[model samples]
Target: MPTAHAPGTTPITGVTIDAVLAGRLVRPLFQPIVDLSTRTVVGVEALARGPAGSALEFPDRLFAAAGAAGRLGELDMLCFERALEGAMAAPVAPPLLFANGEPAVMDQPLSPRLMELFASRPSFRAILEYTERALPSVPGSLLRLAGQIQLGGNGVALDDVGVDPMSLAFLPVLEPEVIKLDMSLLRDPHATHSRTVCAVVRGEARRTGALVIAEGIETEDDLVTAREMGAQWGQGWLFGRPGPLDGAGHRYDRAAAAAVRASRPGFHQPDGTPFEVASARAPRLPGTAEGIAAALDRVRHIAASDDAAVVVASTDDLPVSLYELAGQARSTIVLDRPVPGEFAVAVIGPGYGHAVCFRSTGGPELVMVDDLPTVAAVSRVLLNRHTRG
Candidate 1:
């Protein structure tokens, strides 16, 4: 077994990236995710470290070196394998193991060895956690990977949420089993931004029954604040630091455990246009293209001031205003589809969902949906098409 390194150890230089990957110098550390109500460890997040006393010991440096060498995917897979191996070797395995995955490599096929490792431990439950950093460029990829992970009887989590306002718009699209609040929210729970994030997260959790885990809880006060913010589970120094899995066992919270095991249904479908899928669930309102366009324009104006808003529109209509919306909204996607006299727009955010789909052939009628799930479905459909095109 590789010895775990303490922080601030003497840094050794000249460790080549090849040596690190070939030698498998990465070490796995487990930090417990405690059930705040029961104070029991429900899960452990796997953290990767580099060789002891080496400059690459820090994850940022290790990953940076790998990225610079154009081997980030390989390094990411290595870290994942090490984390699983460490968990399997532990004397008292956690009920849940949360592993970090880089979005850039999430679409790649899993290694045979890793697949076998997972098969070998059929009883072990793993939840793959990713961030929103890659959503704008690769929503389709992330959605596909998430579907694959859940289909394999594992779970998915959105990590470090609240750091990006746009993440709020993706809540329904991914439908993560666990939503890990970013550490910054806990550091200043009373901040206006923090409160807004908490309210949105709490509402989503209630609607979908997703488990909320607060990160960076180092004191009793932080724990209290986390509960008030509707976090059922938490991770940080107060529970345990990232280290070997020894002395980390605790009773499981049955309800929380069940929630972790119960995977939500997939949102993205293989077939159907954005309008076809979303309109099926929502009511189509009778209106002219001009009226629908006017309503969408109003939505665009409102979304411009909202930090969490995401706006997507077809370029056939409203070409100039789309540029202005792009500058003010958290995320803006302009789809270039030539359907004369057709107009479509979707605006979604934390607590809001609105979409306008107009078809000229159908006597200038349109489908308008305000339901969150339908709106998210519309956004996903458009995003998938954009990615494929």
Candidate 2:
């Protein structure tokens, strides 16, 4: 175990470029992020540790050293390669690998390296993680590379934009597949109402047409905050701490046991979110828009109600002439349509609403609701799923 260094302990005052990489450099460590409900480890951020004897072991210090050495691009690529390789070797293979990227790297040719890595591991689908802090001066070429990388079946993500103005601008342009929120921002206890920064992120994330992932979560409170803030996915210590790429415990930090001790083991917050719990097992893949409607139609038919007597609606369905849950009151039931056969007929609506429930099996299973705003909201929830794959 390494002890925390004192102030000015190991300064990278004048390390040359070659000096920085001459030793056992680039140590990769994992951090665990849990699904809000399941309390299971969803993914890990393969953080970079600098050279064995260098003063730049931590992320901030390592990046600083790279910057000073005029080798920021080199370091970024190093970390990306390490993260991809580490993730591939990990025991729990996460579908999403968040390798950090910088504007400088985007300024250069990135596709060849990306293509080469994936060519070696055909099954690995990774996300190039970008943060608000990293803005590309050359937006044109940057977006081109981003698009090219994604077209290869990989993804581009804006990591931890979290309501920042830079991220806000990044959203309309980058349009990344994944929009990650720094869990530290989402976990702010000051997020009291819908007007807080966290709330603002939730709203903006919806319009951007990207999946929201929370990062930096360290406790049950953080996970609760993530759900309350409308984050479909996030990572932190409570879910699963990062271990070795080969499935060993985290070398520097012991997150698994610490989380087990710190977490309250409860799902419901005062806000009533079913946090930190997973479906008893992997859920059936949610039905398609047509499939959902068909299921509802069957339910209403068996209920012996006219289409108006008992409404059949898609998961794409939403409040019409009635109220719907908003803010922390919304509950999304993510389902996978596995063992495809018949869906039990029942109107699934938010609690306390005068929503209809039709019960039946096998029939015209769905009815479509044609409203734009409702459609948008349904699309928001419907498109968001727990499928890491």
Candidate 3:
């Protein structure tokens, strides 16, 4: 068990990359990527750390030594392999595994060995993250390489976007699927300069349909700032620090457990009475725009008298239009793949707070108004299940 180092620890010196590699002590820790809207661990970012108590224990020091020794490629490969191994062994399946790749290696032709590694794990959706500082001086090759990566079915994320002038320059060219904002952007989200830069990144990301992730969040205010800046996903100590895969999985497990509890009968209620939870009994709708709109039309008709209804759609069957509608309506949306053939959608209102249940599949998908908080709690459980699945 390694003693977690303080965030303020100074970068250690004197570590030799060769010695670190010879020891084979480069281990991978996973930091959870949380979906702020759902409060779930949607993915994990693999961070490589050296052995505990060693000079190379700090990743910055280890990588610095590797760079000094001109063995950065070797170090990165080691980290990449170890990250895959550890992530696969985690208790909970992460939707995405984020790994760092250096430009020096990525600029060259793709490695057969790396491709084989990816091929071996068909279930893992890996995203290769490249920092702005590491971007190849020859931007063309990097962009071409990024295209190749996507062709191979993996995703690309630009780390620390807006951190450097180079990042801003390459934003349009790379057009990564995920844009990780530099933590500094949130130092003062409202500041004129910060706001301007953030808007630029946000605009480009939105234009490209890229997901924005705010990094280095350490406060509730920071989280809020990140949200205001249009970050759909977030990673930082406030969520959880980088730790062993099992540990990160445990954190996710805890969250899922809480979500399940929140969805259960007595969870938010003080009196310990039970509310009817219904499932969808109707035919499965195709997970298409028209299908979802049709289903939603039924819901809208049922809730015509109320404000809105909580909709739990199949995570595996989620339609882009449905997602957009949920976003527009500000409705409680759960996107879990393994949701049973039918689930529940509830409406709560004026007098009582507990929501009446509706079968997901059948004609009675709408329920009477109940307690608002209870309905919300149930929706969370369904959403949590989606995260876990």
Candidate 2, lDDT over the whole model: 0.47
Better of 1 and 2 by lDDT: 1
Q: For residues 221-271, write the lDDT of model 2, one tens digit per residue.
A: 777777776776677655565556675443322232222111111101111
User: Per-residue CA lDDT of candidate 3, range 1-389, in tens?
Assistant: 54455476654455567877877678888888888777678778999988666677878778888888888878888888778778777776576788888766555654565667777854557787988754424333454555566664677788987555446544543557788988888886777756766777777765657778899888888888899998878989988988887755443423421221011122212221111332122223234445445655544444453332334443433333444433322234344344454434433322222333333454423343333434444443443333221
Best candidate according to TM-score: 1
C-alpha local distance difference test of each model: 0.78, 0.47, 0.60
User: For residue 158, what is the lDDT in candidate 2?
Assistant: 74
- RMSD of candidates 1 onward, in order: 3.6, 15.8, 17.3
Name the 10 consecutive residues with the lowest summed lDDT in model 2. Answer: 267-276
Poorest 10 consecutive residues by lDDT, candidate 1: 263-272
Candidate 2 wrongly placed segments (more than 4 Å): 1-17, 22-24, 111-114, 187-200, 204-209, 248-389
Alpha-carbon deviation at 17 in model 2, angstroms = 4.1
Estimate the TM-score of every prediction: 0.88, 0.55, 0.59
Residue lDDT tens for model 1, 49-146? 88877778878889998999989988898998998998888876777889999877666778776788877854467898988786666676677767
Q: How does residue 79 of candidate 2 score in lDDT?
A: 74
